[model samples]
Target chain A: MSTTTPPRPRRSRAERYRSALWLLTKRDLRVRYSTSALGYFWSILDPLVMSGIYWFVFVVVLDKGGDIGEKPYIVFLIAALLPWMWFTGTISDSTRAFLREAKLVRSTSIPRTIWVARLVLSKGLEFLASIPVLIIFAVIFGAQANWNLVWTYPLAIILQAILVLGLGLIVAPLVVFFRDLERAVKLILRFLFYASPIVYSTLDIPAAIQPWAALNPLTGIFALYRSGLYPEQLMVFPIVMSAVISVLVLGIGLLVFRRYERAVLKEI
Target chain B: MTEPIISVTDLGIHFRRNKARRRSFKDLFAGSARRSRPGEFWAFRNLSFDVAPGEAIGVVGRNGQGKSTLLKLVAGVILPDEGRVRVNAGVAPLIEITGGFVSDLSVRDNVYLTAGLHGMTKAEVAARFDEIIAFAEIEDFVDTPYKHLSSGMKVRIAFSVIAQLDEPVILVDEVLAVGDKAFREKCYGRIDELLSAGRTLFFVSHNERDLRRFCSRGIYLDKGKLVLDGPIADVLDRYNADYNNPTP
Candidate 1:
């Protein structure tokens, strides 16, 4: 039942997971970039193209562009849209995190949570890399930097990271057990694209609907992001709501992940 | 008589068929009742064993007889259905030849990454990097992407990385099949070196001669049951007789 010999000191669970998380994250980043010729350029290109299309269609073609505010509609759209791309991209990819590396999951004894964490970390790195693009747009649009911008950016980044971790933790294991969750997750994210305030500001919604819309954690997150670009439109309600909801989702996601972690290997 | 470095009590593992999974869109939308339940079957059942330090164990069985399952249970990759497996020492599992290799990463990168996953620190992997590459004899291709390597080169790289891992127990499942004759000889030499250094080994091989070469004791499993367990010669004799003269 026990060893009389002096065993090598075992690393704590947190330490082991931390190391594995780092290595896997590195591997994911290297593999992703090495496959394509353009490499990291592809990360910025996705949001740039997407924002350009939305800007042209909404501002040039549709009448909604004039209502966005003093800043160019492109600037406003990039501020909100870049973070949305990161949040949605991380969540969707993480749904297949475990399933993608079925052999690695079955072969290694590293904590299974590292798979989902790798996806989050790698995508987060991409999101961070894309921030310079956002800053360039803001400078061109003549948006003035303020003291509030410094804290708000990190705050939004940390909150969105936490929210993605929690959701990914839940989705990664759940999709392994229920394969259809992979498809269902994509569908839900597509619907959520319109549901969140990605294109237009949340203020444009009716006052009756604004409170209901604020219930979405992303509404608060996007509000935080948008507030950085257009401080005049900043609302504290969504930021506070996002903070509360992120913690709740993190707690629930951890519970779901732990419950299903052991069962996942057998199912896969 | 000594305490086992690895012990299994009432160990069992069962797998459910894919039919039991809610894989269809209709199944998710319509709920659980519409999906057919997958039948469950045990891979191994009611098995118990204890492996002493420095013992080399040969796990022999026919295909689909849970030979690999037992190794997986010991390595802690899969959970046992009803019972426990307690490993009191570090384990290195060679279940897949390219288990953790990223195709786009260079061989040098994979060596560090794979070694780190097995609990080696960055400094440790760096110290042994040259030794692993030399042992694998692919130092020329160390900077090449893993996908670019031929299948044989990949195996050599993977085996070299794992061979340098300093674990108390090593679980090998038929990785010898991948290597060339020269590499297999190197692997045999490595096994001899490991045994001499007092490492515990559990080798699962279908080749009887390969098992006899490395193992002093043999465990024969038949249809998830412990058919025989004893000295290598006796267990092999019984196994060979059973196979040569089948019961109707």
Candidate 2:
């Protein structure tokens, strides 16, 4: 009997992996849109709405815009808020990466990291889609759009992406073993929102704790974000610190994911 | 001798005795999904096997005896605790084909999504798109949401996509029960063609006729141990005698 052996993958391994990740991320976006008439609207709407609420509370209600942030406070609020949305959204969704697609996770031989990375990319894409809104607010508020964004914006995005994906890698597998971590991830995110620099700049925090505040990776990353509008917010020390911390988080995430992936697969 | 397409060594997987079937969303599918108590049990242990390219092997065991777990290991979906499984080629796995799809997406999208998950590129899926839809006989419903399809149609669509994958190793998990007789005949024909083309097959089934039709070698598993490793007919006879079923 004449028989033909199966052909190997024509593309390199990395190419195949990337396409798989993209396909999953597309599926995620497609489902989100199909299920809700307002899917795209909601992704962009979230940051805008949050920016408005914070601007109203801190500036309108508290009358502290001049004391706390750059002028045209809405711009200040949204500049950091957009990326914050990506960070929190990715973190929140990563908690369920394995559980949500347990069957698919078990079916594919692709590196399990793709599962969590897809969430990071999808949420990051939403943040990208919402950038135009940030620009509009920046324009409307007559916020001084400086050239620092050319460098800092990209820097901040890379740092945040690394940070979020690392954290996702860590969280996705861990949640499979400890289901309670899923709920705990949410609670931590809720606390992280206030603890991060969304409502106020890291500089506004008391001098006594400013060093510790900068240690929150978001402080430097967000400062890089604000540099697009408020150049003075950019600082050498914190951006350097953010880079160091983001890379460290990613390193830890990789180690945790590798150590637990087998256990996670068994648990799933 | 051709190199073995798959090799498993000292294979063992354990489960927690306490985390039973009711644990969470995962347990919903894992009928035996992994479990644990303060104590533990090995779902499988000290088992090993290999398949030369184009070899057809049938895995026979009662339900919840880790038959699916073995396939999962070969498919590289789950890690073994005590041993290892190494595969030289890609796998087109039918282990819960219907579970990988998105209910809210259209058939077109689900096809691309699932095919991609199995590592099929866009060009490949698009090339096989019409043929896959034609095979599933769901041409009219390609644009419709997947959840809208009948359960039978869902399986047909999923199976069609998997059938077209160029991967050399085909892992079947008794999913041939999908669709009607005519559809099953078509599936049988497809499996036959792949086998004739020298694809390696690892099929798990309870039906003696199906096992005899596809596999020359059989591995009989009982209570997490390899009870016998021999010819299909003998393994079936042994399995039948052990389980008190009338022999063929």
Candidate 3:
């Protein structure tokens, strides 16, 4: 009963992947905010609440108000802290990005990299929305904003997004094969929180440990953010290091993801 | 004769068996050397076939006979380990009809989302939106979250969306088992329409009646090997005879 007919033209691979990425990212954001009353508020709420708590502990509890800098403790803490929330949130959630969508991952022909990319994009958006909170605090706290703010903020965001994407790409696929890595990722994030310059300036660190702290890619990115907020304290080394390290991390991530792409189906 | 639209040559796919067991921290702490080695199990091996355009192939198999795995391979969902599957036509797979729906999104959003995943462009989905909703017959619940809808409703929406895909090759895996008589009959009509339009098809089902009704060719699989391939009647006859007269 069937007759042969000519085939229709199809879209190119790049076009298909781009559409898939957009659709999946939109779906992720919608589902995330659908069930809760707070909706988009939750994205910024975590960092906002954490910044407030940390400000209390450092200034009121520890009486270190004068030592932080000329900037208010709240403003200084959030400059780097907000971006940290974006990075850590994307990393922790990405470990389960593949495993959570086991059904979609196992059944569809869409690229596996879509999962990691969607996580980065969605978290990156939330991170972007939270930026105004930093700006509002900076303006209110009389931060020494200047022309340097223009380049530093965008550069810091782009560098951080690249760094998180690379890390997310590596972890998303690896966690599928190694379930223990999921729990291990959380512990590592906690260690990294204190390890990076979230609460204290890198300059405050003992000269001995400053070298070791500079090795973290985020250390440089966050330092750039601090520099953007307070121009006088801007350090050039970390910004250049961040730009270089971000590219290296992205390259490594792409290699690791491609190698494990085919093997991931069976594990999932 | 024209070339086959789909060809499989010595295809093989295997999965790791001890994945979960190897992940157990207790086993690692206990130093159980035997459990540490992950074993591999072949889902299928050395499978080769060519499907011509406009051919509807029925895949028959027992549980674990790798019927779904073959469809997955054809759909490009899973890659083969040993050989290759080459298809000249774009395939529209109907496996796990409601599996891709996001529960929190309304039925309308899911239609767009699932259709987009199946390779439909945004403008295409937008153009066919009303037709899809009308076919699904869930106009009143269009805005209702997918999770709140009845299973039958979900199946109808999923089927309606996929039925509109213009891909030249179609893969179906028992998606007709859901919904009421009216809806099942509707789906059957749509499949008939696809076949009449000259689309190649791979229909996997354990139900012999359904297979015989929709397919002229049959491939019988047993224990991950293709045991028989011929006319639908001949394959079923041999398959039933094997069951009735067990060689001792």
Q: Each candidate: what lDDT?
A: 0.82, 0.86, 0.83
What's the TM-score of each model vs. the native?
0.89, 0.93, 0.91
Give the DockQ (C-alpha) for candidate 2: 0.47
Please give, as one word, the docking class of candidate 3.
acceptable
The numbered model that scores best in lDDT is: 2
Model 3 interface DockQ:
0.41
Candidate 3, superposed: residue stretches over 4 Å from native = A1-9, A232-234, B24-38, B245-248
Model 3 agreement with the true structure over B32-131: per-residue lDDT tens digits: 2222244767778899999999999999877777898899989998888779999887888888777788888999889899888877888888878887
Give me the displacement of residue A6 in model 3, in angstroms. 9.6
Model 1 lDDT tens row, B104-210: 78899989999899888898788788989989888899899889999998889888777778688989999888778989998888878777778899999978887
Fraction of native contacts (fnat) of each candidate = 0.53, 0.71, 0.49
Scoring each candidate complex against the real one, what DockQ results?
0.37, 0.47, 0.41
Of candidate 2 chain A, the 10-residue stretch with the lowest lDDT total is A1-10
